[model samples]
Target: MKAWFARDYGRPDVLRLEEVAKPVPKPGEILVKVHATTVNSGDRRIRACDLPPGMKTLGRLALGWSRPRQPVLGTELSGVVEAVGQGVTRFSPGEAVYAFPGGRMGAHAEYVLLKETGPVAHLPEGVDMQTGAALCFGGTTALTFLRRGAVRAGQSMLVLGGAGAVGSAMVQLGKLAGAHVAATTSAGNLDLVRAHGADTVIDYQKTDIARLAERFEVIADTVEAMDFATAQKLLTPNGRYLAIAGTLKEMLGSLRKGPEGKRMIAGPADERIEDIVELGRLAALGQYRPHIDKIYAFTDMPAAHAHVDTGRKRGSVVVQVAQ
Candidate 1:
């Protein structure tokens, strides 16, 4: 099997494509013949082993200390089951599926394994492997924020990176929940975000998000590091301040403030299998869809990583590993 492996963490150049042994399924695990996989900001961050002050120590302890604990970089994948381990009873060979291999990094190859109890779900009817490949992180991340924010009908939502993969999905999810959605993007994506259901568009380059006259009941931010005081000020009372991009300290600070407005903020919600399955249902229902920015051939994993690292992708970046 040919797969991209990370020998030492650094740039996309660190990734070398070579033949490697295909992974086998362990008890309760399923071996998948990968069709496609997608990259996320979290993937890049991990490759670089970039964590905030105290977080680095935690990562070192969990992953590898001196070098990368996991040699492969890909996380979310869409594939077909070639074999199901002994303890696995729900799925059989040849069933199409998708999943997040929770903390492990082997999805960027032709074969990867995961426990059936992980975030595995059958591809939603009419949802092809390409789209399924891209949904795990974007969907779960969006779902988590919306749930934590507890967005309700008729409320207003402001997504900081609306044209982005996760942000675009949030726009759709927020609108489906009956919220008037707004998103921040450059002039290029003004119409695109609107089409996704964002009622208002903020030119983050030209307009000051912190100074917008209209506030929101829920603001979903994926740009990570935004001023808490600024976002908090824009929320309606009992508003939820959700930021997947914000740092741990920021989230904790908002939580501790005990301020009004569900000012409750968080990232990556829970990675429950049910949540992913639910997201697939929503995609099948046309409420949420994969916003693909580009699809690169599996060998071009380096190029894909470079694009994601630039933080300029319009949506998710898909890597076609096999199909």
Candidate 2:
């Protein structure tokens, strides 16, 4: 099997494709011959050892001190089941599936092993492998935060950084939940954001968000650009502030009581089979389509990482791992 390995973190060039032994499924596990995977923001962060403020030591401890704990750096994948281990009756050889390993992080390869009961599900009919590979990370993250914020129909919701992968997902899910969605993005992505169902799109470069008089019942900051103070001012009373990307200080602030009934929601999103299943359902229904910015060949994964590092990618950057 061929896999991309990040032995040391620094630049995109650090990722090297090399021949590695194929993994065999253990008990209750299934081996997948990966067809497509994504190089998302999470991959870029891990590849560069980019940690939020005050989290470097903790990040190093969890990831690696001098090198990555897991050399393969992809988080989600879509593929065909090639083999199944003992007692794995949920899936069989030749079944198409998508799996979100999330922080487990070993999807950047020709083959991946997933537990039958993990965050793995069959690919919805008609959903291509690239789209399947792109769905989980952003979709699951958006769903988790929306649920945490208790977003409901008729309420106003604001999503900052609406052009990126997770941001776009948040906009779509928020609207699907019946909330009137407003999103912020660069001038270039105004149409893109609006196309994702945002009722109002604010051009961050042209309009200052701080000057806006409108307040939202739920404000999701996917760009880590909002401070608690700003969030407090922008949220209506009893509103929820979802810090989808927050600094370490803001993470600790999640423990502190907020003024009035407002609250801050910040933490890692849960990886659940149910969420993946729901995403598949939405895709099948044509209600949720993950935007793909580019597709790179497996051998060009390093270039994919470089593209994601630029911070301007409109959506998920997919890597075609197999034909």
Candidate 3:
């Protein structure tokens, strides 16, 4: 089987495409023939070994002390079941599926084996493989924020990086959750964010976003670029700040805000399988939609990684693996 591997953690150049042995599923797992996969922010952090403080420590344990402990570096996949391991009753051969695989993180290949119990689910009959793969990270993360935070319909919500994958997902899901969604993006991607139900768009380059304020009930720091002190003013009295890329500094300030549900800080583990399933259900029912920015060939995984590394991507970027 063909796969991409990184010998050591460094850059996109460290990743190389090669022929590797196909993996068989263990009991309670299913072997998938990967059709589509995505480049997540987490994948980029792992590729360069530039993880956050806590993640860096975990990298030493799960990845490697000096280099990558696990050579493969991709997550969130949409594929078809090639074979099911014993005791896996949810799917059968040829069934279409998409999964997060969480800590497993081996979706950048022709085949990956994952447990049926994780953030994995069956693709609705109408959804394509590419969109399916894109759902795990963006879908689950947004759901977690909306669910765990103090957001309600008719409230105002702002997504700092609204044009990117996770940000766009937040815009869409935020709207679906009945909030008046606002997003930040370059002037070039304003239409992209607005198309996904964003009621307000801020061209981050043109003006100071913090100054133009309607106090928000929920402010999601998906990009982590905005300073918490300034962002605090945008929140309503009982507002919540769910930082997708929050830091220890922000967490402490949020902690100071005390019980009003003002500071809700959490890690990337914010994604849950149930949350993703709920997003899927909403998508299936036409209450939600995925607006893909572009698709790249699977062989151009390196280039795709490089593009995202620029930190100026629009909406969701996907890699078509099988087609």
Whole-model alpha-carbon lDDT for candidate 1: 0.81
Q: Which lDDT values do the candidates have, in the order given? A: 0.81, 0.93, 0.79
lDDT of model number 3: 0.79
User: What tens-digit string does per-residue lDDT give for candidate 3 at 1-323?
Assistant: 99888778877888899998888888998899999988877788778887665456755677788777777777788899999889999999999888887556888899998878877788887878877888767777778777778578898998888887778888988887789998898888998888888999999899788887478888888887576566677877777878778655555565566455466555545657777787667767766666666688989998888887887767566888997
Model 1 is weakest, by summed lDDT over 10 consecutive residues, at: 261-270
Which residue pairs come into collision in candidate 2? none
Candidate 2, superposed: residue stretches over 4 Å from native: none
Better of 1 and 3 by TM-score: 1
lDDT of 1 at 146: 78
Tell me the tens digit of each residue's lDDT in model 2 across 225-265: 77878889988998888999987777788887588888898
- State the displacement of the C-alpha of residue 19, model 1, in Å, after optimal TM-score superposition: 2.5
Give the higher-lDDT candidate: 2 or 3: 2
Identify the leading candidate in terms of TM-score: 2
